[model samples]
Each structure stands twice: as C-alpha cells, then as structure tokens.
Target: MLLVPAAHAQGPAPALPTAKPRPPAPAQPAADPAYEAARAAFEALPEAQRRAIQDSLVWTGDYNAVTAGTFGRRTYEGIVGWQRRQGVEPTGILTVRDRPALDAAGEAVRKSLRFTVQADPASGAVIGVPEKLLARKSPLPRGTRWQSTDGRVTLDTTSSPPGGTDLDALFERATAVTPERKVTYKVRKPDFLVVTGETPTGRFYIRHAAGADGIRGFTMSYDKTLTAEVDRLVIAVANSFSPFPNAAPAPEATPSATLSPGGARPGAGAPAPFAPPPLPGSVARPVATGLALGNGRVLTAAAALETCPSPLIGGAPARLTLRDPTGALALLEGGQHAQGAQPPAIRVEAPASGEALVVLGAEAKGAAVAPGTAGAGSVFAPLQPGAGGAPVLDRSGRLVGLVARFPATPRLIAGVMPPTSHALVPAGTIAAFLAQAGVAPGELAPAHPQGASLGAAAAPVLGSVVAISCGR
Candidate 1:
C-alpha cells in the first residue's frame, strides 16, 4: 500500500492509448459529358435497333450482359469496350460510319449460324436459336429440345401446369451441388429464377418464370471448349426468351374461320364454338388477311407470324414454306381452299401515281373493300389492323400489289406528331418473290372496259381472300 502511493502520482499522468482515425473514402470520378451525350444518342434509337447494336457488340466479343435494348451502366461499358477495340478514342458512341461496319460484321456471324427467333410449339415460349448450329430438333413430353450436330450444345424448353412443383423446389433442384454440377451464381425472385453454373464438361444457364399458365423455362448448355463463342450468346438467348409472349391472344378471343365472310368453303358446316374468356393478362389474337394462291398455297404478311407457334389459316393448320427476304411477304403451304377457285391474275407493270385502286381483304366482320390510290411504289389507303396481305387490284381486276404492315413511323409537322399512314408491297416485288419460289402467277388478261367501279373490280377476288389467325 505504501509503494502504491508513489506509483499513483506517476500513474495519473499516464493516458490510455488512442485509436487511429480512419482514412477518407476515395473520390468518385467526374462525369464525362461526351459519354453522356453518346449514351443519349444511343438511347434515342428504337428498341429493335438498340438490341441489334448490342447483338453486334456481343458477336464482336465486347459485350457479355443481357441484350435488353435498355440503356444502363453495363451497356455503356460494352460500348466503350467496343470503341477501344476499334483503335479509336473510347467515346462510347457509335457513329453512322461505325455502325455499318459493326452491323456487317454481326450479320456475317448471324448468317453463318442461321440465327432465327422461334416459338416453342408446346409451351408457347419464344426464344432465339442458331438453326445451323442446332440442326436437330426433337419433341419433349411437355416441351421442346434442340441440339448441335455433335451434341455438344443443347437447349431445352419445359413447362409445368399450375398444380405442378413450386418455384422453391425447382430452385433447390437446379442449384443442388451434384458431382456433375457446380453452381457459380444464382438468383431467385417472387416469380422467376436464374441459375448459372458449370457442368462436368460444359457450362449451363437456366431460367424459369411463373404465371397463371404455370411455370415455363429453358436450359442451355455448351461445351467448355466453345466458351469463347457461346458465352455472349447465352446472354442474347436469355434476353430474347419470352416465357409467355404478351402478343398471345385469349382462347375465347381467337378469331374463328366464320369471322371472315370468305373463310368458309362451299359447305364447311357451322363455325367452331368459341372457348371461355381467357384468364387475366391475356391479349387479343393477332389477325391478318391472306390471298389464296392456287394448289394449296397462300400468301400473307410475315409480321403476323412472328411469334406464332401454330398458325391457322381459315381454321386449318398450315406450314410456312418461304419468306421474302425483305420481310414483307410469306408463303404458306397446305392451306385448305374452296374447289375450282381461280387465283387472280398478277400485273407486272406498276400503276402510275394517283391511279385509283381497290383493296380487298377478309376482315373481322366480313369480306371488305377499301379504295386506294397508287403512289410512287406503294398504295395509299386507310388500312386497318388486319388489312395486311389484302390484295390491291387495278380497275381491270388484276392484282397490283399486297398491303404491307409497317410500323407507324412518327413524323414532325409544325413541331407536332401526327398519325402515320400504311403502304403496300408493289407488284414488281411480289412478282420477283413468286418467281423465286417457282410459282408462276397468272398472267394479266386483256384490260377490262374503262370506268369500272372499284367495288365491281374487287368482286372477282373477294372469296379468294381469307383471314389468318395465329396461336402462341
């Protein structure tokens, strides 16, 4: 105790050790105005065009994220990466000059792969496949499957009804650490799940979505040796996947053959009965018109068949045989037709501008006709949604062209946008397409007497036009 008294005096001056202060966080880099401007320019493009650019980047091995067609940090980084590879300043902007080269490069790869977008007939899900790569296609019990020639790359699409396994179970099974699989990443959401991992000899990507129609998803696996070529493709395929295409119509709203005045053959009996209304979140069926090309062939707009897994022509199943490279027309084979129906004659010479024309179509209500005028290369008419592929006839009842469904391009008038108009595929183009398909169109006969009314001119071809309905 006495010794502690002397130490207490010295101990009072002693202070506890002090903790070191933390260093300040690193500063963020300043925003680049040029890069922002570049992004703005890219964002201004249409969604389809944006996705195309991203696809080009992926093909060039500069992008590895989803091709969502939306602007974000990942997209920006991809653009910058592409710019750097071109040996130019990395402004992250694609100039008009730069785009052509990039698109050409991408197109080459697509051509080699025979890339195409298709919907699974079983699940009604849309996805992109490299047709040349996956030369073999087979049916699954509840889905569809595709594989490469050597079976190194495989794709499988599957679905389950409402009372089937839940998402939790699926997630657990997909991510399970089996001896043959090693999951590297996984994500789960209320209505979807995505898992990526490596197999014993390859890599795999799985995606699934839940909805009123139940669960729908796909799995893609590719050999490890081809990772350089397939890694980016996985992102593209995923982006294009649509578990439930929004364009699909409700069962009840599907247009029946009877809806078209000309759809019923001479004696096809009563129209098919309609189903109950579709469940919540269903859309109207996409409808279009088609022209009867004799011998079980039909011609229609290709756009209407974009997401259709099973296309119906006048309530009969049909197969698409050929498509116009210009994306304006498609030829369907094996469609049913009335007996002794004569296809309309085709006029090779285009109509002069301002010439009166008649547009014939099988509309929702019935067979209908509208007056039009020939422009430089298109027929100008007040066309409706299902008017595509309607026959455009001359005063002599000769086929001049077919209505084409083009996206409504907005135009500025006095700083205001107005409704857009529709155009048609000219006779010359249609003739060339027919020739390529080895179908000789009927030659035009002697001209009819002058001054024939539009209604009278269209009468001969009314029954030849039929409505086209597609189911997803």
Candidate 2:
C-alpha cells in the first residue's frame, strides 16, 4: 500500500528510468600500408600460383578456407598468423624470402599426411583423404569406410536412393542422444544436414546434402586428442568433396589391329601389350588425350608426362623417347599399336582466323568431337578438363594444330569477365617437331568440300586418338 501511494504521488514514477548511453566504440586503427601493399602483390600473381600458395597455407594449418585463389580477410589473417609463428614481423604477406621456408614446412606436413583426392566408384563421390593417416579401407553396406591405423580416426561415406530415408529422418537419427552418445550441435536445412557431438570413443561430425542423385554424405570421428590436427583436415576434406563428378567410362577391351583401317598388323615377334591395373582405389588420376603415330609410337602434351614420368598410353605403360624444347610436345616410343596405322595427315598450313574446325579427343564414349573456330593463335571452343593434347582438324579433316592447353578457369578481371579461349600449337610447329624426332609426316588426304561435315572429316583420325592417364 505504501509503494502504490508513492508511485501515484510521483505520477507514474517519471516514466521508467532510461538506460545509460553506450560509449562510442573506439575508432578502428587505420589499415597498415604494408598489408595493403602485400595484398596487392598477391592479387597480381597468376591464379594458379596463388592457389598453390593457398594450398601451402592449408597444409601448414594456418588457413582453413577453400583454396580459391581469391584473397580475403581470412587469407590475410592466416598470413599474419604464419608470419608471427615464424618469428617475423606480422606483415600479412608472403615475401620472396618467406615463400621458400613456408613451402618447405608445408611440404613436410603434406608428405607425412599423403593427402590425395580419390574418386569412389561405389558411391560416385569424389573426396580428398589423408591416405597415410587412414591406411585401412573397407567396403560399407551403402558406401566405403576408412580408418586410421590405431583405430583412433574413422571416415564413412554413404549414399541413399531417392525416396529412401529423407533428410529429416537422417538428421533425427544423427542428432538423437543415446546413453553413450551426447548431442551437442545440430543444424538442419532444406537440402543439407550437419550434426556434431561426443561419442564414447571421441567426437564425431556428420554432413549430408540432397541432390538429384539423392543423398550423399560423410561422417568423421576421431579422438579428442587429435582435435587440432583433425580440425584442419576436416576443412580440406569438405572443400574437396564432390558428390557427383563426371561419370568415368567403363573399362573397355583392347582393340585389335584390324580396328585400324589401312594399318599394318604387328609382327608375330611383337611383345603383347597389357593394360595397367585400375588406378589404386580409383584415385583422381590425371588424364589427357594422345595421338597415335604408328609403329608403337605416340605424341602427347609434355605437361601430362611431367606429373607421371611413366604415363599409360591406351592403358599400357609408355616410354618417353623425346620432348620438344618448348615443353609443349612429347613423344613416346612404347605402347605398341598396329604396326602401320595410318597417322592423321599433318597439314603444315595453319588454320586461318575464324576458320571452322573440329576437335577430336579420346573420351568416355570413345572418340568425341566438338566444333571450334580458329583464332590468331588459339581456338575458341567448349572443352573439358582432359582436352589438352587433342587434335584440331580443318573442315576437310586435315590436321591444323593440337590443343596445347585448355581454357583457364573463369576469373574476374577488374569486375569484368575475360574471354574464354584455349591455346593451340600450330601444325607447322608440330611438323618441325616431328621432323626433329625423325618421324614421318603422313601424306594429306583428298580435301573435302568446305561445306562438308567436320565430324565426317575427323572420322578417320578418331581411331588414332588414345586416352592417357597418369597416377601417383
């Protein structure tokens, strides 16, 4: 009664007392000029080189973001952190002197981990794995499983068909608390789910995403003691995950010499060729196309050979016989084919700008073709990743050039998109290279009409193309 009387006397207590005003946040320190200069320098580097640097940072555990080549606040902070750890001024930039040491440190860790990207045939999923850490691999009911040597870490990849357990149901099961499992963090979205918590053995993390192919996901568990190491690895694995990569072609039976029309069969004394074993566990092997030069010889891009000194040509091991000084061409002396398979006619004349052309390559569906137009020294065409070393033929099927490089991945240039084009090695250069290697340039075929179908003109040469794969 006394309190009510006091409030009434004060006319509603002068309204509720207002909250005190918060002090203005301290002015943010100005950005360091050195940091700005370093960022500018990094951004000026080639995209591929920039990505390599980011990859190094990831291995060193200073970065947890995707190796996208694009720099951002996270990348700057990571650089600064690494600098501090190296007992250098925190410049937030990698100088020429700093790069060597950084690379060495990162390389050591990478070697120890033996990280590799693997394509899982069972679940049709591609992911990166620390092969050295997870040496034990086993088949699961729905997919594949990998475990560490001491059984302290484990990874499982699973897939479900459409109309199977929906995302909601899976999330429920993943997050449900059991007597031995404690749920800590959970998130559910329209097309994905994530659950993390503790288990009797250690901690666990699960991620699943819905796609047209249904659901694909992975679960990882490791001992608490490995949190620091495992956490960085988790970021890399997640960034490298591809639920559905391009479908690889099924293994095919070796073609007989008769398949090459107008080609001479090998002599009876010729050694029998054999296909290399399927890449260990279907790893993400580097692949390219090669042109057969008859007499057990082949020509392909030198870059592909750099990764795998002994590459497989048409699934058989090949020996490098010669490499062009420019590093754009390579010759292999093994992987025996039909003795006198007619090599595609090499036209010394380069294709004129805007000339219509056809590109031929060895693909999942045997020989594939794509229409293209010749530029000043390149070709504009929609090409796939392994298209390098493919043959570019004129409208009349005459060899015009070879695809030296694929189009670079798209990048923004001052907020503008750059033109997409692939590099082409002219037929003149190829002919000279062939002469230097002592290989005969085959005779030209009768020219087809300009209006003739490019695909028809390329038919004869398709048989000469072979798929080249290199493995770690």
Candidate 3:
C-alpha cells in the first residue's frame, strides 16, 4: 500500500504531432478580434472535452500575468490542438469540414469559461499535476492505464476509467503502488534540466521534448519543488518498473581499471568509470529568465547556448543582432567589439551593470529574458531566423551566443557546454578581453552576476557505499 508523500510530473514524453502554433506578430495591440473569436470558440467547447482540457490545462502563466489573447501564440495552438484531439477544427477561417466542429468547439469553450484551481488542499495553494501526457511508453507490454483512484490508487489495465486526479500525488504513489505492475519509462533516462523560475503563481518545467527541435513544452513545474521525493521514487521505479514480462539486464558498461604496478585491491581489478550518479528525479531546473533588451537581445547563459555551435566556437570573436519576427529592430550587438581581433568561438565576460541576460534555465516555457533588475529593460525572446537574425545575451543582456543547433536537427538532447565557453563568460577573463578590444572601462559598468546558481558551482557528492536488495 504505497502512499502519496506528495509531489508530481516530468517533461513531456515526445509529444505527438501537434497543430502548428501560428505565432502572432510581435508588438501588437492588446485586443485583437481574431484572438477574441478563437478564444470564444474554445471557451465554448462541449462540457466533456472541455473538462478534459481543463484537467490537461496546467496553467503556466504567472498568476495575474495577463496575456493578450493573441493569434498564433504557441500556447493558443496547443490549447486549440487539445480541442482538435477531441475532434474540432478551430482556425478562425472556418473550413467547410470545420464549421460543425467549430460551432461545437466554440460553444464548449464558452460554456467552459470558468476558473479552475487544482490546489493542494493542505496548503490551499493552487496546484498543478503533470498531465498524463505520456512521458513515453513503458517497456511493459501490457501498457499503462489508470486503474482506480481515491485518497489512494489501485490499478488493472482494462478495468479503469480515465479521469484527472492529483497528478503530483499520483506520481508519488505510482512510484511504489504495489500489485500495481511496475512500469519503467525506459526512455526517460536521467538528464539535466535547469530550473529557471519559481513563484507563488506556479513553477515551470521547461524541456526540449523529444525530437521536437528548438521547441519545448511547459508543465506546471511541480517537479522543481518535489524533486527529492520524486527522485527517490524514480530510482525505485527504475529498479522495479516493469511492464516487461521477461526483463533484460541492463547491459554491462565497459569496466575501467587503473594500471596499478601490482594487481589492485581485491575488488578494484575492473571497475566501472565513476558514473555521475543520478539525481533523485534525474531532473534539474532550467535557467528561465525574463531579462529582455530593446535590441532583441534576450539575456541568457552560455550553458543555454550549448546547442548553438559544436566544438563550440568560443573565445573567437563574433557579432550578433536580435530581431523579432516582424523585422522590427530588437537589439544590435556584435559577439565581440574588438577592432581587429578575430572573433573567438567563445568570449567570456561579466555583464556590465544594466545589461541584460536570459535565464537559460530548466523550467518550462523554454528560455525567457530577465533584466538584471526589475523595471530596467526586459530581455527579448530568441529572434526567429532571418537577416541580422538573433543576438543571444548573457545574464546582463550583453551579446553571448546564438541558437546554432536547433532541435529540428536529429541531435539527441544531451548536456551543455562548460562554463568557460558559455554566455556567462568569467568576469576576470572578460575584463581583460574587453580592454584588449579597446573597450574602455567606463563604456560599460561591471556587474559581476555569478553565472552559477543553486548548484552550478561544482560541489562534491559524498556518500557511504551500501548494497541493497533487488526486491527492495
């Protein structure tokens, strides 16, 4: 009888095909007829489908952060797609095949317009549980379905109903719910995700989901706070997680051995390389920031730009400019302003006071800009592809890197670049580089925002080795 120790959710497993979010042109008026119409159409959806969407809607917008219901917004498309999944077409220009669905969907959206607060009754705080959006299929052949629920849960594949419940707690109980077949989300191998923002409004789980390049999915960001408990269960799940009838032993890793003059100690002959042990949830927060700049320079870190260029061309100087999709000027800055110095593949420097940098963080709502201080200039979003295209920023909104490697490519997501090569170039080294390029001290004020946060600065993992039972 496992219990909900509290907590929930993970990055979306590879998302199924989704509607192409028609991003609205930037700098638009607060009210748009198209947006209102579409919204009305959605709010007016049928009660059942609307209920599913409500359950699925892990509201990510910050509380009180009023969003201009705009056309082509990613969130909008995602929401509309949810309606489509329920069999509705919602483009404003209603197609003949879409009118009936549109009329029905619009009515549902209208009737469904009501506040939904998934809360932790204990804290009275609104809560978000990860949508049972399949993180990925389990290795188990029987497959997974909701068994049953109450304060506790029970499971049997066919004998179940699909309904939304406290996903956080469900995830907690699912970790060790017995007689409940163990299920392994084999593909969700542990990886790093940076936690960008945490607030009373909500947390964000930002991740590069599956093969969907450049794009990321936003979850309620529950895992950020409940990580410790989540991870403990994740490990237990890994070991016991089995939908697989005949389990396969994880293949042996190439064992390592040091050439000690004599054969090493009793058990030291051939040992595995020191593997970076998994974090409880094998999850980490993203560096989400809102440091926006006028010139399209949304500040972030070199770590966030890890996917930009390979062997990552750092130290070598380069120039960058940020532009919004509308071709409106955002920010114009070079990677390096050195008069004659060749652009290093990477440049490390401290952001001058008042400059902007983005939080290339782990939370959802893939990266956003944050000003060094509030009310200063905000950071810009990554400029879409085009001329004078995009200029990435450091924490202080100075030029840093670019989005060279998009998710569109076949690259499997992995770790980021080392600190030295990233947007957060070291203050000490950056100071020198500035001078060498003839940049005067007074030109930019130095604000040494440590590129490292919560756990970035390397820390030791200390533990006492122990052996435990497989049946755990």
Candidate 4:
C-alpha cells in the first residue's frame, strides 16, 4: 500500500471557524527594579564581555539575538530563556550572583570543546590544546606531537636549534612538512618564518623561529571544515606557545624532521588503540553507530573504524574496509550474528529544503530516530557523538543520506566550543562511491507495506541498526 503524500494525509478536519480574532494585550508597565538593575549590570560589561554573553546565548540557539554589545529586548529574552533552562526564575536580568552559574556553564562548554593547556616539562613545550579533540601526546624526534583521535587535527613542535637555522633552511623544512599541500601563506624573514597550506585531507600551518635560542616552533594541522576555529586556535596556540626557562632541545633524537611518505609523522599515522576506558562498574561501552547493510556487511563512522581492528556490529564481528574521507563515511563487511537484518535502500534523490527526514541509528540501548530538516546541502539534525554513519531516511523510509560527525567550528559558547553536530551526505554521493567500488548498497525498503504508518515503516530499518564496538 502506498502512503499518502503528507500534504493530503488523513486527519480530522476542523469545523468552520466561528470565533473572532482576540484583541492585543495591553502594554506592560515600566521595568521592575530587579530587571532595571540587571540591565544596568549587563550594560556595564565591556564590549568583549557582552559579546561573550551574546555568543553563549547563540550557542543555546538564539538566532534572533545579535552579538552586539548593546542590551535590547532580544538579548534580555535570551537571558531569560537561558535562566529558565537553569531552573532559575526568568528574571530577565543577570545578577552578580549569576556569575558562578554562568561561568560554570561556560566551563562546561570549554570542556566539551577539549580546550586545555598541554605542558610538557620534559620537552619544554607548553601549548594550549583542545584536549577532547586530541589524544596520546608523544615525544617526537625533536619535540612533541599530539594527534586528534580522529586523525583530523595534529600539533607538533620541533626542537630548538641552539642557534636557529637560517631563514632559507627553515623555510625549506617547513614547506616540506606536507609536500603536496597547497601553500596558502608564506613569509620569510631573517629570524622568523611561517608557511601555511592545505592538503587533500586537511590543512597545515608551520611557524619557525631562529635566534640565539635556536629554532623553536610548532605546526598545526587540522580539518579544513573547521576553518573558523582553526583561525582562532592558530592564534591562541601561537600566543600561548612557549618554552619554559632553560628549555633546550633534547639530546640527539631522530636526525630529520621529515614526514613519512604517508604525510604523517613516524608511528603517528595509525589510529590509537581500540581499548576505550572501561565504563563505570566495569560495564561495556558502545563505540559508534553501525548501519547493517545485510549480506554480512555494516557501515560505521570512519573515526570508529580507525582505532578498532576488529569491530563488532550487533555483537557480530565485522572487518573494516572502504573509507571515504570527503564523505566522512566508512563501511564494514561481515556481520553474520544479526538475524532478520533489512537495510534501507538508497533514494538516489536529494531531499528538498526544509523537508522532514528521519535519521536512524543505534546509540546506547537500541535503535533511535533523530528527526531532522533538510538544509540546502545536507539535513541538519541534533545528534550524539556515536551516531556517525547512520542511515538518513525520508518520510517514506527511503535512504537519502548517511550521517557524519565533523568537528564543529570553534566558537566560545560559554567557555568552550560546541559539540560536534551531525550532517547527512546526500544519496548521490553514496551511490557514486558504491559505483566506484563496484558494490551495490542495500535496497530501499518497500514504502507503507500493509498501509503501515511512518513509524512502522521505520522499525525494520532501525532493527538493522546496531551499536558498533571494539573490545576484547
């Protein structure tokens, strides 16, 4: 049975209108003392502070309020809304007492963004970092390097040359970090040098200093999609970058700072180990969402695949293969444990802007659905960390896209950056990829079988969704 178009879906028809429009309410009296005092306190804040407050509100999804330092009705309403969320009275005013809560909220955001200072006493390297974004800091031949767990961000500092190398040599070594990178910026001076470029996978920025102290510098490589935060991070990292007093290069290490043919530092290209810290009470932990494609195949996020050599889908072991970086998607083959698996078929058509869509995946307990609206190029949905690589389906249960998690652009939400959000890769991209690999994806589930409701049509597909993992 075919499902009726949403425009004509059956429902109770409304009776003829009989009531007249109500009159507008009378204007309220002057602002209360509390509100007035709050406004004064807010107005006293410096421009930057006001902007920070505005940014915090924006992170809470206040598209109506402007970040300008001026206090207005919109900003007041936003503050009231936020206060209500905090279980506080909607006073529409920020009291000095609110400072603690506000700061705590900001700190939470910072923690979410993984913003923390990394100080290596041994390497004499101290730098600011997004801790949540990076893992496994290790001593490099010259200094130290920290790679993002997902392989999207990298930061490394090279040892100081007791007397910095000449500008020419520094320039050569810096540019060679990523040979194929497209140089976006270059500067050469007698004592300082910098080079920036973009690679197929991401972008890299290199800074070198030469003087009596020798060459002490660091490079930042990150995913291009995070350009906004990248700029700010670059600035922050550089400003905070310093070597402790008497900091000197470690004894002769690796002779060269050159990268391996793979464009990663030695022993740094591979993903980290798959052993996630045991959950509280020694329980197991789910790694990522996996889309069961049937016929002994499943799909999951590329990041999850990176660290797991032997991943499990629905308690069935699977082998990882096929990775698309541009699409941020991964495919796994072999999952014989799941019974009655039925993967949704690809729609082969893009969703219209503002169209309602459903994102399916298994997060923690079992399968879940995240409702989303189609955006210009992707579907915007509220997503959790592990929902990457889930199938995105239209109202009729046709596969329109795949979910991907990308590092959100860095912005001060409170004190930290926003958590990564999910976006849907259109079906055409997936189809083209499958075509290139000579593998056909799952077929679209039959729509409205037995006059089933949308929820019913979605159940089987969700049943095929699994929480993937890598554990002993």
TM-score of 2: 0.44
Worst 10 residues of 1 by lDDT: 1-10
Superposition error at 462 for model 2 (Å):
50
Overall local distance difference test of candidate 1: 0.63
Task: Tell me each candidate's RMSD, in Å, in order.
Answer: 31.3, 26.7, 22.6, 23.5
TM-score for each of the candidates = 0.46, 0.44, 0.25, 0.36
Clash statistics: count for each candidate: 0, 0, 93, 9
Q: Score each candidate by Cα lDDT.
A: 0.63, 0.64, 0.25, 0.55
Q: Write the per-residue lDDT of candidate 2 for residues 1-472, one digit (tens) a residue.
A: 0000010111221222232332343454687787788789888888787767877887888876556676656578778889999999888878888889888987888778898889887776787889999999999977899999999989899988665756556755886778999965443333454566787768887877655466777888889888778877776676567665653322342332111221111121111101011122232333677788876667876654544555775455665666676768877655555234567778787788988777775543244455577898887764444667888888777888888855333332211112246788888888878877667877656656554454356657767777676633
Expressed as tens digits, the lDDT of each residue in 336-410 for candidate 4 is 534335556778878889776766655444554444568766766544445567777786777787775433223
Could you tell me the TM-score of candidate 3? 0.25
lDDT tens digits, residue span 49-125, model 3:
43333223223110111111222233355455545555665444334454454445534432343222232222221
lDDT of 4 at 450: 30
Arranged by lDDT, best first: 2, 1, 4, 3
- Give model 4's TM-score versus the native structure: 0.36
Query: Candidate 1: where are CA atoms >4 Å away?
Result: 1-27, 246-472
Q: Residue 83 in candidate 4 has what lDDT? A: 88
Error of 4 at 150 (Å): 53
lDDT of 1 by residue, 169-221 (tens): 67668867788889755543334556678877888888776555667788889
